[model samples]
Target: MKLLLDFFPIVLFFVAFKLWGIYVATGVAIAATVAQIAWLRYSTGKVEPMQWLSLGIIVVFGGATILAHDETFIKWKPTVLYWLMGGALAIGLLGFRKNLLKSVMGAQLELPETAWRAMTWSWVLFFAVMGVLNLWVAFHFDTATWVNFKLFGGLGLMAVFVIGQALYLGRYVKDGKEVPVEKP
Candidate 1:
């Protein structure tokens, strides 16, 4: 359900492109993105920061594609989005603080602060890798291949990485214990 909800706009883009034209597809994708975001806000009472940023990028690049009648804008969207996010994550690590990853994921995970810090660093690096990968594939591959990668490659890679992370996290669990409750 979450995947479908998140992917609704991209799907709309593809379908609209096929049915109407590139401009129409861009418009449809924008509309779908906005509608989905509104629905999310209404139902959930909170919106993710990432979602807003994504919407902004879609509007800018997708809208540019429509207005300029050029596909390059849409092609650049992923590269820009991922790099922006990755750069933010990487830059934000300059400050000293409690475990960054643990702060966000702590409710679901119990790990030493050191481990959490390492995980956070890994995520920072991973996003950078994803951004570079997006740029590489989008520029190097054919349009159809790029589109396919955009729609499928990302989710597949994410699923694999997440499963791998789960496995790694599982290994870090100690002494057959549940998520820890620290002593008062």
Candidate 2:
């Protein structure tokens, strides 16, 4: 359910792009993102920081795409978002000595400092690579192909990365319990 909610705007955008075109799809994406945020705020009494960032990016880039009659702004949106997230994680880990990934997921999973650091760094690299990938696709392909890649290829890569992360973390689990890491 949460996953579907997260992809709501993208799914709508893809459908709109197929049915209409880029400008119409951009409008649909903007409206869908705004609606998603409003629904989340109304239902949960708050929205996550990432969700708010997504809303801001969509509104700015999608608005530009529509108003200026250029699809380039929309095409760059994903790269900007990914880079921003990666930068935030990198800054939190390097500059502040805080693992933002652990801070968020700590309540759900018990892991050693080493594991947390590895996970955080992996995410940082993933986002950085994803940002570059988005740009590569956006520039190298046609608008329709980029739109297809945005929905399918982007999501496919994310799913694969997540599965790989889970497999990597699987080693830390033993007999239904988290294995404790020994201190050096």
Candidate 3:
């Protein structure tokens, strides 16, 4: 489904890494990301902003990894992307006084202003932490270990965080509708 499509590049990268090596894996990742974006655009008539951002990051870092014959660029790609996302959310909230999470999901889930603010900050924190975690693993571990972490650890952490977020948000909903609550 949509989830499989979203993870197509990462899965391909992992498989390529197992069969070949980091450089070939990087090439496969770059090509896979490009193909993924193209397929999305062709089928959906448009690609999401995040998807475009992913494509740009991969092309830049992956291209550097290939051309320079170094794995460091690819190693830093995830951290860079994560920090950029975290920075964007932080700036949007602090500078513009906007809650992007609320803006995006408000139509689907109604929650108090406080809840929205908390949710946004939670995501901001998650991204920041994830970025640091990526770097820690990338530098502390070997290439094979880093690659495994990139696919398994990264996705596992994301899944856990998402599940936690869902549980946290569950309290605000009842029977598919927002539960009414008093505001201070």
Best by lDDT: 2
Tell me the deviation in Å of residue 184 in model 2. Answer: 9.2
User: Candidate 1, which segments miss by more than 4 Å at Cα?
Assistant: 17-22, 96-100, 174-184
Cα lDDT tens digits, model 1, 102-142, are 65687877776666667777777777787788778878987
| Residues 7-75 of candidate 2: C-alpha lDDT, one tens digit per residue | 999999999999999999999999999999999999889899999999999999999999999999999
| Residue-wise C-alpha lDDT for candidate 3, range 1-184, written one tens digit per residue | 8899999999999999999999999999999999999999899899989899999999999999999999999999999999888888889899999988888887888789888888888988999998999899899999999989999999999999999999999998888877986767
Instruction: Please tell me which model should have the higher lDDT, number 2 or number 3.
Output: 2
Q: How much lDDT does each candidate structure score?
A: 0.78, 0.95, 0.92
Alpha-carbon deviation at 53 in model 3, angstroms: 0.8
Instruction: For candidate 1, list the clashing residue pairs, or say none.
Output: none
TM-score of 1: 0.84
What is the alpha-carbon lDDT for the whole of candidate 2?
A: 0.95
Kindly report which residue stretches of model 3 are placed more than 4 angstroms away from their true locations once superposed: 181-184
Name the candidate, 1 or 2, with the larger lDDT value.
2
